[model samples]
Target: MILTYAKTLMFLLMSYAMAETEVGENDLNEVSDQVYGVKINKCCELNEIMVDSVCRLAELLNQSMWEPQFKTEDGIAAALKYFNYVTGVPDCATTQQRPIFDLGKSEDELNLLTDGRLQHLIHHLHSSDQIKDDPLITNTYSIHEAIAIPEVKEPSSYIHDQAKYCMDKIIITSSNITGQYALVCVPEVIINWKETSFLMKKILNPLFHAIAMVLYLLVAIIYFVIPTLRDLAGNIITTINICLIVSQAADLVRIFTELSNHVSFMVTDIILYISLLGAFFWLNSFGFYIWKTFKSRNVFLRVTDVRKYCYYSSVVWFAVGVMAAMAICAHFLLDSGSNPYKKMRLSNTIILEDIEQETIGWLGIAVFFTPVAFTIIFNLFFYVTTLKVIKRINIYGRIHYKLKGCFDLFLQIFLIMTTAWLFLLLSWLNFDGLFYAHIVVNLLQAILIFYVCVVRQSHVTFLLRKSCCYAEPIPTGEWGDEMTHMNGGNY
Candidate 1:
């Protein structure tokens, strides 16, 4: 709505306070070739000049119909602004570009746009408050609009400030980054909710699959695998680690064990599609540390630094878990819906997808680099310290003070874990799924830890065993016997 037509439609709508006609659909086609030029009229009775002809003249003569325009972040933003304005709804959050934009193709090109055109469209959005603002047209994620978000858990009333849903939801079952750089993002996205329900009736959630009480007891005892070392292995590093591993493993087994019943669930084959660069770095360093330890023979790890790493990783991981748990709790407790309990069951994975997509490159850089900068500084201090200790204390010293292997082993794990964190950065870049990337690295970490504890330890133990074996044979003949003979000769 423009002020130049103020005497006409403006008076009708405002003074009359309720008139609704402005550029009727019937007249839209015939109304104008007059956007920027002189025009003849189909409505000949009214044509002194349609007067709105030429943008400049219309503005100059107090007869403007259209507002000015400018660019926003993307062309989609511009489209969203105009559409939301027209439709009276909010904007949509978009997906992470899968580098698909880099390819050359026709549809791939920016939609038949002239340079600097969107800039013109966006300028108008800021200038006028009186014009009808469309929700679809300007999806500036200002936390106020009412477009549907993934869960629709928070029902914000403003159409423009609402949230959008993730097309595919996956609840990350495990975010383990301890062992082999492994993490698993388990999909709890329930696109196939009906099928899941039907199957649950038959299989009964696997843990409680048996219907009869006796059968339930028997089944639970038998298949439940009752938490053991065999179940945990060296892979479960902490309580958090154990919980994550079991939960994800159970989730996977539940889905698969009840495959026919829950067949409709659309799960990502994360193992296949995802890359584990984190695990790669962890393993690469694991091998390096092992080679150094075995060849140098005097290497050992310190326990203090191990405690420190464990403490911090646990704290950070715990906080992340708590935040996630609280969010789920809040959604369930706060929703005014009649069945919040039922809704909490899914705990939607689609939210992660939306987050993964919406986060831009700059944020990605910050997330990756912040930990990275800290890790580098930490590692530099330890590395220089280690070298200083070596030069000063001297491993080859005759006293044979015993804590050497322990110290080196501790340092080995420290260097491996700290240096390997960058694996996550590279992993995020390569694999879109963070959970799976963690799994890959964590698995490698397991392999490394085992190799360090077993293989490296075995070599040291083997050396000790040999030394023990030679104790009897080497004693007098080597040094003591020679000294005795010399004394005899001297006497």
Candidate 2:
């Protein structure tokens, strides 16, 4: 939906320029003289609009309002209006038709116009090849030039707000037309929006999430279908898959909601928070179970599987609930106006600064990563402890094939999930280069789980009978069998 609207806006801009050419009308010199105090008869033609002037009006000056409006539809709509006015959208009074003084006379109208003007302005600059990578100038170089220009000094106060605060810069060369140095402006939200949309938001996100949901359902069905496979490990894996399904579903829903511009921010965020955190806790439980199994001298310390599952469920769900509650409280307590998912990602790592708390960055880290950090640390400990226990057992006798297999499966899951999340954290930390890696790894999670649990499991092979001939029964025991000799039958 965004892409289509953008294309239509560009078409209208070009059509307007073409129509002006037919009528032999020129507003460039007038706009440049009035807005930037520069006299120019001609400049680089972009829909008959000067690139340098647009840079100043769209980006350099719009920095103050960009943060508060960029995440919401009101800001996006306001941006289109401002762009139409500046670009001479049809019926919008131009300097030729009406006095320049008539242009933003009312404070309230200017306030409304200023909210989202940056979005469309950045779009035009990018389309004109004036921002991202131009042969004559770059965004960083443009900022320095803009700072030096006398005309830009009046609005220089907002220049300090850079990419970290969700803004980008574009270099504007004006020497050829104005007999003066070039100017610049940085673009943040719009550029990031396009890049993220292409990478995962608009296309890849829904595709991967849909595929993952299907895979999760398939694996779950197989787990429930095969009676012998419904052991403790199977139950844990099944629960994790279910949580993942929920997470993916929520993500898909969010993508649509954002595109339609009717977002229920609080509801979607809560669902995502609970489901994603729930998946992590369930994964942590898998690690914990393995470590406890190795450390125990007897099978599950003689505890029934039902009771054990109940205990695990309680702990995992409670942790998820606690994280959700903390996030909800932070939303209301810290900055009610802030939308942490501004960057179109799940984590609330990026947000505008609030006067009292400095910014919601601290709140995001505290509410989200604090529990995640602890979970990752504990999972690592469990993995290490399990390995040590295996080494000690190896010193005495060979480990059981089933136990070893379980360890391998759990380790694969742990590594995949850990690596994906680590890259996700790095991406959120402004590691622009690692975003592609993060996307690839994150999308492969469901595939990895299916491969490890369904395709490679001996019990699965036994149930499917794809590997053996004549449906002959394989002698592989169930995962819940007591390893009496290995650890005194306390499995």
Candidate 3:
């Protein structure tokens, strides 16, 4: 009952105050005409004076009803000051031999009366505060007086289209560089609680990438420590591990940098792309090595040719580096002719474009993807050839169980990579649902490799036993060609 009474009392007080302080249309019209010599009872002619009249009327309304206190003289001066600052009115240009104001039809031609200029001129009015040392408008009545105005209860509609145009133009213009460049042109993408993919991108993706980096490092260390593990397969796996580490490190750096520094961010991105492409090329080497082994019909011999592997690695690395450099150059130089808003350089004015967006150009997307596409194609070809050779081996003499295990490991790695790439393609096509899956598959690759190549093998335990002097020494013939083909054999 007490709360209801308080509400009723407040409503009555507000109504009384509004009725006392309300400024009628006649008063505003009088002020407008007095200032601009144009009546505001109806829309006037579309000319300079009419525009000034509308702007002056808006300023009067804003000062009387929205401000802390009504000041007709001050409002008139402020409006005139703003108009002069923006339009340079009453000042004749020597070149044109007339007023500096150009009432041009095109937005570009009317440079002085642009929306950007108007917004900038009146940006200070966005804030409302008590007058620190004022005789008329004190702290107590300042807040209440503005609210008590009738316009606060019901919005004041403009009867004239010109007046509406005046308010509309000023209200929509941005007050800051971020608003003009980032917020205004781009369509906002709101990620709510339901958007699990965005959350995964923010948190889970980095966590998994870190975990995978550690796992890859551990596997690489294991391969290096175990002398018997340093075979053809070991060298290739170590290269793959290094590539994964570089790629993950680059990605993690890129994620945390907030994209504030353009040069460092671009460099990280370049490293990431090159490392990823290199890893896939190494995967292609997997099928190539396996297919070569089977086709030679030398099942008993392990091809641990260091020189051959070095040559292949050098070629792959050099090719990947060249392609990446070319792609980066092409991306910046070529123009895709996409939507101007989509492109980084929205205008010739460099201040208006986002730094990150400007650095990452759109045209070289296909050029960069070209190497990935080629690697995937070759990966498929090598896998198919390896599978055919495997079928032939199965039909004839029985293959060693250890060799088949190595092949299975290779196949798992290949599938993981291919599936991750496919998911990336889908996500690129705007399949938002697959975004989390893409991140998970791409980031957890090293974890799977560590599990299969290190944890699943008895090599680490065998080495530990040997170091502690608690295991029987291996027979001389046992560490022969067959053992080399095992990759990581059970002790």
Candidate 4:
């Protein structure tokens, strides 16, 4: 559904170019400005028509949803209106004609687009690369650039609002400086991701709650989840450190807004990418750890070494750690000023998209499959080595329940959401399509995080809290007391 709309938008944009050439009665107009008077008069007429149409559509869409209106629908409809306007659909005053008024000399004829005007403006901008990319018109970059330009002298003000409030301030101050060829994206990706995450989280709670109860019961037997005993802690810590670095890289964005230098922002992007490499390693580590716990026969999850992969399966974490002791000796110092976004295909580190992104995507699939392979291997061992052990062992019952508790399909939603985000990021990096995928993933990730967080709180929280707590240490591989009791079917 979404891709179809995108192609249709692209086709319409190309059609507009052809339409502009043929629309003149003599078929000889060289520029949009060659035909004028109707620009002002028709712009007004189209504005009025669209506002009226949207107000009516608003009422209809609201009625269909059975309420005054939904915030989500309103946002989508508004965006759709802007998209429609940017493309300059037929009969829009914008399509018929548009006026470029001089701010210094002419009366301000640019009426801020209301819903009706939105359709005309967005359609024009969407189809006309000239309109959308022009910094003076509606480009996303112009705003990004403006945000980098600073007015407030206070340091705290810069850090707090950079992501949210700062962008708006920059736009208002930017006025006419926004150049053409700047709008990088529209919010198509932003809307869809938000909805699906909400839907998944809503459905996963009951099983999670049941699982958590089982985990709390198992706490008397298991000392801890196996992943935390060794390298996994370091991996999680590394993930956190990279996040801190990314937060630090964020300073360059502020510097850009303050000085209006695009270079600083570019540097910041470099740092972000470098940091993401670290982040991805830890995330993969955590994902694999969780996979192990869910599938392990002993009900204790152990972290496996990811080394010995076919290719760049992430070797940097260990190499970097080995060199960390040299930091005090002037080796491997922090490159606070260094741009991490600088793309490189280092021989050792596995990049997801090393001209071989498609090949690496398979590794992600393999990362997913490692547990399935482990499950088969372990289940067979459990049958041969531990099946009779269970008959004699009461604690063995806890093992069965907690193992089931740890791995739920409910948990996969987070992995799925992250995978989608990763694909979107890779695609954007490759410049396949923009706006649609990123926006969807960003919005989806947010919703997924919230849903997953809540589900974790309600269901898995018990498992995590029980494991992390200092209540007491217990035996490693036996069936938990709770599991043994539950074997009596008490649960």
**Reference-based TM-score of each model:** 0.27, 0.53, 0.54, 0.28
lDDT scores of the candidates, listed in order: 0.30, 0.51, 0.50, 0.31
lDDT of 4 by residue, 1-491 (tens): 99999999999999998887678644453343244311111211222222211212324223221111111212342211111112221232111111222122221112222222211011111123333343333311122112222442321111111111100001112333221111011211112323433233222322332333333223212223433221332234334333434533442242212222223443343344334444444444444444444345564432323342212234545633333223222211332222222121211122111110001122232333343344334434433343343345455334344433333322343254346446544654635244245434544543444344334433334434544674543223233333333443431
RMSD of 1: 23.5
Segments of candidate 3 deviating more than 4 angstroms: 1-198, 257-259, 299-302, 336-356, 359-363, 394-403, 458-491
Ranking by TM-score: 3, 2, 4, 1
lDDT of 4 at 348: 16
What C-alpha RMSD separates each model from the true structure?
23.5, 18.1, 18.1, 24.7
* Reference-based lDDT, residue 158, model 3: 10
lDDT of 3 by residue, 36-95 (tens): 542111122222122222333444334221111111322232222211111222111111
What's the lDDT for residue 259 in model 2? 30
Model 2 Cα lDDT, one tens digit per residue, 384-461: 888888887743322344456667888898887777668767765556467656656667888888888888765575
Error of 4 at 374 (Å): 19
Q: Please, what are the lDDT tens digits per residue for candidate 1 over residues 1-491?
A: 56668778766668554333344543553443223222111111121112211112233434323221323435443321221112111122222111101011101111211222111011111212211132211221211111134444432211111121101101111221111000112223334344534344223333331222232232223212222111111122232223323333333432342232232221212221111212222222323333343345453333123453455445545544443444334434443222111011222322211211121223322432344355456545545654555556544522112234434554565555554455644644533355344444544544554455435653333433434665532212222122222333421
Error of 4 at 432 (Å): 12
Is candidate 1 or 3 superior in lDDT? Answer: 3
Candidate 3 lDDT: 0.50
**Candidate order (lDDT):** 2, 3, 4, 1
* Candidate number that wins on TM-score, 2 or 4: 2
